[model samples]
Target: MVTDIIAQAFVDFIRRVCECENLWKAHAKDLELAKVGDEVTKAISEGVEGEYGPVTVKVRKKLLGRREVRVWLYGNEIDVDALLAEISKARSRAAWLLNDCSENALLETLYKYEDRYLIEVAQRNLDKVKNICAGELPRIEFGEAPAHVVEGVVKGVRIYLSGHGTSA
Candidate 1:
């Protein structure tokens, strides 16, 4: 029936969002490794009118703390616009799916997603509070990087869903 089809579509949308989050998290981890020692160089030559130069920059391998770990390559200048666009598309799809469902079903789905959002937010908040209370920030080892990015994706999707237009 139409209801079954709509339910399936919603399930598929959720699956796709999870897959994208995983993909982005993996990509972020790779980028963290790659960005170490990334270099930009500037060449400057004296010109008659003024200084004319090409700017180049270089990055060195730096230890990143827990706070720095949150600053991943995923939201960096390189692909953030594309990432946001993709999230917007997902939100639009979720909204359209909600429209297709009956009011009761839509409300159920919204409640479910909202619960998931709240659980994730609480977990993150607890982690931050624990860190602060412990007086030790989480350390970012190579293995810990992807989870941070995945958490970021969860927060982003939650924000998108809870924001102005999508609210129940």
Candidate 2:
């Protein structure tokens, strides 16, 4: 049962990162269009196909072909960098939990297969996993998986909208 939870949690982390990647890709495309003074609002909305749940976008057309785009996830304003950082941290914690639980022979033997929602199952079982381990878990350094563009112009429309360099 515990191993099942661990696997589910690992999968959830992976899926969440995938969703973030989708969002980043949308940002890139929209920003590129905005840079060229093209209509970006429609492009932005069309990019998000509701796969990651409710994502809201607010775009303002500024003078001289500048645009300001802001995004929200589940009604909370989000900074792409900050959102990625938080999700990465959560995934790391989940990874540690999964690792520690998988090391237990008894727990490994008791794991059962299920087709239920994996993330919900993992979240529900996480506390139980910690109790089962009942000891300090060694820090597991994933060493930064190749992530979304971490900085510079690719982040969002900020650079493109600010008229910082040669226009596209």
Candidate 3:
């Protein structure tokens, strides 16, 4: 129960940093925000593993004036350098899309880019949640029950019967 509270606090910290207002505005078109929300839900469902968790993202590209520009988003563990690299790769692919295909052909590329970006943001938020949880848990005494155990046994009775004594 205490760990749950700590986890929730961590989520709240992520929410504060991610900002609902910005998140809403960022995905207002075509239920993009809704999709991002779903991804976040999926990430949380995966639970915290070590310092972070993993999530999936989709990215796409849009073409304008003979040039295909890519947009990307993602959700998962935030590694800023890795994200930048993914973005760079997406942009390069977008260039190829522009050179070899029509505007309509860029649809998949645009979606892929956007998804990548969403995943990246989600990861950053997850990290924040982890940090918050780490900070809050030390102050509480939840008893020692092996750090690996997320839930402790409560309100349970153990009975042992012996020749000389009976215990419960």
Each prediction's whole-model lDDT (CA): 0.34, 0.38, 0.33
Taking the tens digit of each residue's C-alpha lDDT, what string does model 1 give over 61-101?
A: 35662111111123243332343344445445444443443
Give the range where candidate 1 is weakest over 10 consecutive residues by summed lDDT. Answer: 40-49
**In the order shown, what is each candidate's alpha-carbon RMSD?**
19.6, 21.4, 22.7
- Model 3, 90-146: lDDT tens digits are 445444434433323322232333333323333433433233322322222223333
Candidate 2 residue-wise lDDT, 1-168, digit = tens = 443344443433333333434444545533332232222234353442221334455667789976765666557888745544444554454444345433342233323433233323334444433322223221222233222211211222222222323222
Stretches of candidate 2 off by over 4 Å are 1-69, 103-168
CA deviation > 4 Å runs, candidate 1: 31-168
Best by TM-score: 2
- Ordered by lDDT, highest first, the candidates read 2, 1, 3
